[model samples]
Target: MTIKEKADEILYKTGLYEELKTYGEPHPIGSYRMDMMVYNDLDIDILNNSMTLEKLHTLTNYILKTFRPTWYEAREEVNDEGKTVWFHGFHAILMDELWNFDLWFFDRETITKAEAYCDTITTRCHQNPTLKTTITTIKKDLLTKGLYHYDKYTSMDVYHAVLTENITTTQAFLKTHPLTTY
Candidate 1:
């Protein structure tokens, strides 16, 4: 099935079925809209807070859901007017693929603008001593075991581990770090 179908199925199962709205489009068919407002809940507190693991966990899960894997690369972009706002989305290849799910996260932020968000992720995966190891381990495990690896009862398998453990790590990181607000 297609991503839109999968998303619709998820919404239906979750009982979040809502009316679809439409507006004039920049192109021919017309612009369609939906109330996929989950990203709206990502308040500024999520950025400026020093919680490391919490922020990371939140970010990863977010990207995974908002921009599920497709034939496109995931990206974090920004648009600045006197201020700046961040967007977590996929290129049109993925965008078109998941059009029904509204595959983009519009996070209107000041400090954690698109550039900063990208930089933060880069630093964690590349610069930080401990984080680099953590990310590497996760990637290796993901590659070795593929989809079901995370479900394995092993502490080393980071990605397939329990969801609550992920939450705990995220909360702990947030408690230890200071992600300054914009």
Candidate 2:
């Protein structure tokens, strides 16, 4: 099945697949075609917290199947200070409030990685109420931490800052939530 078809099937299974066919020509970004695919909003309050595990599993399966992120990077093993971490390796900047994978790019692999990370986080958020709360908290932190400044730009746009080590993977992610740096 095609990527789009796979994604559609997963989204349909979730009963949240509202196809946005208006996305026109793919925007040229480096070596890949960039396009917004399924955009969905899952109302957290409506979902029963007691069955969050089931809900999160379904959501994670949907994303892993839908997006088919082949290059999804494993969680970073350690931090700069040698601290162990799992979810901190990469960052995801969710678009609006939609859980739908709105961002995808072929050439730039980081986009795919970021989407994968977002998918994982969103699933975890569904599994735990505190994670749900943290989403807003982190978003607020981004604004205060000056991360919002990089949200509008791309990896290509900030290639220099990344290569020069001015930003670590975590910092880069914090900046714009991109999964990988150029």
Candidate 3:
């Protein structure tokens, strides 16, 4: 089976796959595709409790243990837009014979923002089928070239570059933007 299929099987066994598909949407980020699951307001309130946060961490640890992926790491990033903000998340990489699977976990606000961004892109794709086709072609090309690394660029970045900046090819996009400096 393909790595994605294997990952899906594991996720389904854990019930996370269905929960995410029900509550979230798919987002292709760099070389990996993630389900950006956003917690509802009520759920967010429930998660605000310290005990609940601890339990969530415990659950995360359990998943990491159960999956025994190649690597699992927790991450915190600080984003500033006139004000400093921090986001906490974790990602696990599962490697198979032919491919890799990355699973991401994020806080409510961050996932909500991601969901909105994905929705905008989806809207754009629906409005212009040609743009969608372009994105698919570029992604396939990048995958073939072994250039679709999460640390370097994402399909979303490619789509934005093509749709907004008139950068049509992956080479041009890579030339202009390169990987993020930091």
- The ten-residue window of minimal lDDT in model 1 covers 23-32
Backbone clashes for every candidate come to: 14, 2, 1
Using TM-score as the measure, name the better of candidate 1 and candidate 2: 2
Model 3, 1-182: lDDT tens digits are 54445555545675655543432343333222322211100011111212234544664566566555454453333355332222223344434332233333444565567556666776776787777666766766676777765665566667778789877776777688866565
Off by over 4 Å in 2: 1-104, 107-112, 144-147, 151-182
Query: After TM-score superposition, what is the CA distance of residue 71 in candidate 1 from its true location, in Å?
Result: 4.7
TM-score of 2: 0.25
Please, what are the lDDT tens digits per residue for candidate 1 over residues 1-182?
54334444543453323211011111111011111111111111112213234443454465456446343333344445542222233322232333322223333244335445434444443554554454344444433544212243222233223222442243343343324456
Each model's Cα RMSD: 17.0, 17.0, 7.3
lDDT measured at residue 81 in model 3 versus the true structure, 0 to 100: 38
Question: Per-residue CA lDDT of candidate 2, range 1-182, in tens?
Answer: 43344444444554433321122112222211212122221211111112233433444454455454433333324446454322201122222222323222122233345445445544544676554443344434444555533454333333333333334343444555453546
Among these predictions, the greatest TM-score belongs to: 3
Query: Model 1, stretches more than 4 Å misplaced?
Result: 1-30, 34-57, 62-68, 71-78, 91-182
Clashing pairs in 2: 31-107, 32-107
Ranking according to lDDT, highest score first: 3, 2, 1
